[model samples]
Target: MKRFVLLVVVAGLAGGGYYAYRNQRAGTQQAQASAVSGPRAVPVEVASVETMTVNEEVEALGTLAADESVIIASEIAGRVVALGFKEGERVKAGQDLVKLDTAILDAELKQALADLGLARDTNERLRALVQRGSGTQVALDESTARLASSEARVQLAKAKLAQSTIVAPFSGVVGLRSVGIGDYVSVGKPLIVLTSIDPIKVDFRVPEIYLSRVKVGQPVQVRVDAVPDRTFTGQIFAIDPVVDVNGRAIRLRANVPNGDLALKPGLFARLSITVDQRENAMVIPEMAVVPDGVGKMIYVAENGKARRVAVELGKRLPGKVEVVGGLKPGMQIITAGQMRLRDGSTISVKEKPVQTSQL
Candidate 1:
């Protein structure tokens, strides 16, 4: 009877152990399901729009050029004898640059002078004879003709002598000399590069859209990277009438006062153009704006929901852009979390106490 009681007690203990193990497994599964189900809150950033004064402008790539630049070449062919100016020196217009070997030309001039003296003496004597009727009219005329011919020969010789010297065509600074002393220079050979740096020019192009804003004497602002912490001013002196078909931009020329020569020709520059004034413009961060097909749009926060609003773009800025339409001031925009939401998508906008000016 004791043995039978022992078997019943052992069976009862085994049954309890099995029941406890099944209950534990069921509780663990129920807890895991509860953790997996819910609307998770996504982290996001937000910003509000504000009215500000925006100056409208167009940007373009431009090259820096002098108002007047040219490569002055030799006009005569001869051995270079004397170099009048050094490389990179400032020279005035009409300054003699190169003097060629003129020994032959000098000899020719002297011979012409001697011939003129003889012709004048013969003409003087012949005129006296004609007055006394001792000479025929033909003889006197022949003497006069000889004097005229001698004078013509003198002029020709002088022209040849002038051809042996080359002078600058304009006042400017000279670049490196391409020819040295004793170098044989042919006609049209480049002698040196001459450029007018003072009152130097900065040639920049403007977009066709702002063609009307640019005119003769329109002021242009220029900044050169070579010289920092300085800004120069120039006036529009010329504007091309035709727009470039490939670039769709207009060519513009501005003459800057480079009195100090702080700005050099061929130096790169950053340009800012101001055409018109605008008031009460709504501006937003560039990151907040998104591109759509054939146009552009941005996301705004309304009623705790993401609303995609179409916006007209104008005067794209470095960090911000001007909203021409489809948005109003004092509206919040989803600057961050674009990947997490879509149009009419619910979002929890956590205003992080950011500055309005930061947008």
Candidate 2:
């Protein structure tokens, strides 16, 4: 009876040990399988790469200026007798703006004319006498000299009279007048300011590195704070040949039509110049670009795995970036949830991949 009880206890102990060993082995096998399979799939949102028309552009700040500007001044000293133009009115070229008192100049001209007449009569009489042999040759020569001096005096008097009237040099808007009627003005005194606004100009500067790209007749888009709702278009008309050593930039000027006189001189301007255009350019959302050290990197979805790639970037547009190299059209790029991804990481797209047109 004692031996039977001992045998039964040994059998139970062996069975329990065998069962424990099987459970331990199974757990180890499961762990090994998990290790070989790697981490779970990462959820991400992706957008497909596509081609589009892209413009290579350069941005800069500038200032609006009048096409033509000048301060009108007097060329001779006189009392202002008549004012021909109203303040702030447009004046035509050669239209008189100011007329000085010409009374003294008129009297001077008449006196010179009278002297000229007297000298001519004397010269004629002397020539007649010399031809008749009644006067000396020396006397006739003196009379001729006197006639020439009188003619010069008359021309000088006429010029002084013409100078009394100041006319517009070009068609432009006139500013305030400094001298009023009956006011005496000296030579070079400020009379008014004139500015031509139609076909206004903008002055801007760009980096010298773009010298080869910039050219005359390139289109430019301009905007100003004063005219927030309007965008002005123009073409580059002039470029400074010398580059500024201090700023390493080249100056440029463009002409914008202002027929309505909306643009004025000295207004601040913002300018964009289109340097080049590409018909088919590969682009992706800017959010997909990941900064990798000094270069740029992005993750592409391939066969349910994230493949990291290095890319060379070109021009950057609003919310998009141009991929110059290392990318092709129709490839899906991770736009969001890429933080947890590594090279060859398994990915689970949360939604249908967005098309390039949708972006």
Candidate 3:
């Protein structure tokens, strides 16, 4: 009986020892994981904040338009007898572009000239008789009035004759011809679309904060994707009086000389206006900026750790943002791996600094 009791006691003690050993192993594993993850050095990309000059530029999406864009239309009702020019032809002001049937107009003009001659002969004979006291003054005056009326009819006929031919009002490129030969057109009928592309107008908006920086007749720089290799120079042509309620932005227009005609109307353009350019401005890569709830925040490397701090941002350059406040020269900011960081996260920065290229 004693031997059996001793064996049972020994088995119970062995089981308890095994359970305690397993528990200690689990505790040690949890401690190792916690130590590795807690405030440990993490690999990250970083940038430095330095002082220099920055040009305050107002940026917005730009729309291309034409200063003189219109669709040419006919004023008088007539049949299209001829189309003088082909599509995409360069037309000059006063150049005839379309010709209508003028058979009826020519006949009317001839008749008007004959009526004027008959009235003038009658007026001359009456004036001579009145001077000789053979004709009454009233009759002479009535004849003179009749001749004047005939002269007006002749002028009206000439105007109608001019209307038979359609001419361009301004120099422009003619668009697709809406009318063809032998087509009957009514008054105000569209014949073709003409657009003056030279010195094209580029419309863009400026935020109200920089409204005072823009004005009429100011020079600006313009860039377009279609003409990637070229930078076009332009001048500000207009500024809106009212700010857009929703966006709080003011509309502006720039006149770009499209001498090569490389830039077409309706093509999108990215425009930059140099409002204020400083010779030396402090700037940092845009990626270093972390957005907080109210404004922007950034992580500065200090003693091999990331110290997040609030900053006041200013004008943004190619790939950098001008730090107006809360940072000084020679300060390092985490560029990459900023999202997985805290106020005092240990950072293992790469040996080589990141190179910031054109943005």
Residue pairs whose backbone atoms clash in candidate 3: 52-280, 52-281, 52-282, 53-280, 53-281
Q: Could you estimate the TM-score for every candidate?
A: 0.60, 0.79, 0.66
Q: Give model 2's TM-score versus the native structure.
A: 0.79
lDDT of 2 by residue, 138-240 (tens): 9999999999999999999999999999999899899888889999999998989989988999999999999999999999999999999999999999999
On the 0 to 100 scale, the lDDT of residue 245 in model 3 is 96
lDDT of 1 by residue, 221-251 (tens): 7887788899887777888888999989888
Candidate 1 wrongly placed segments (more than 4 Å): 1-54, 224-230, 260-264, 278-359
* Candidate that would win on TM-score: 2
lDDT of 3: 0.87
Q: Which residue pairs in model 2 clash with each other?
A: none
Q: In candidate 3, where is summed lDDT lowest over 10 consecutive residues?
A: 52-61
Name the TM-score of candidate 1.
0.60
Candidate 2 stretches with Cα past 4 Å from truth are 1-44, 303-305, 345-359
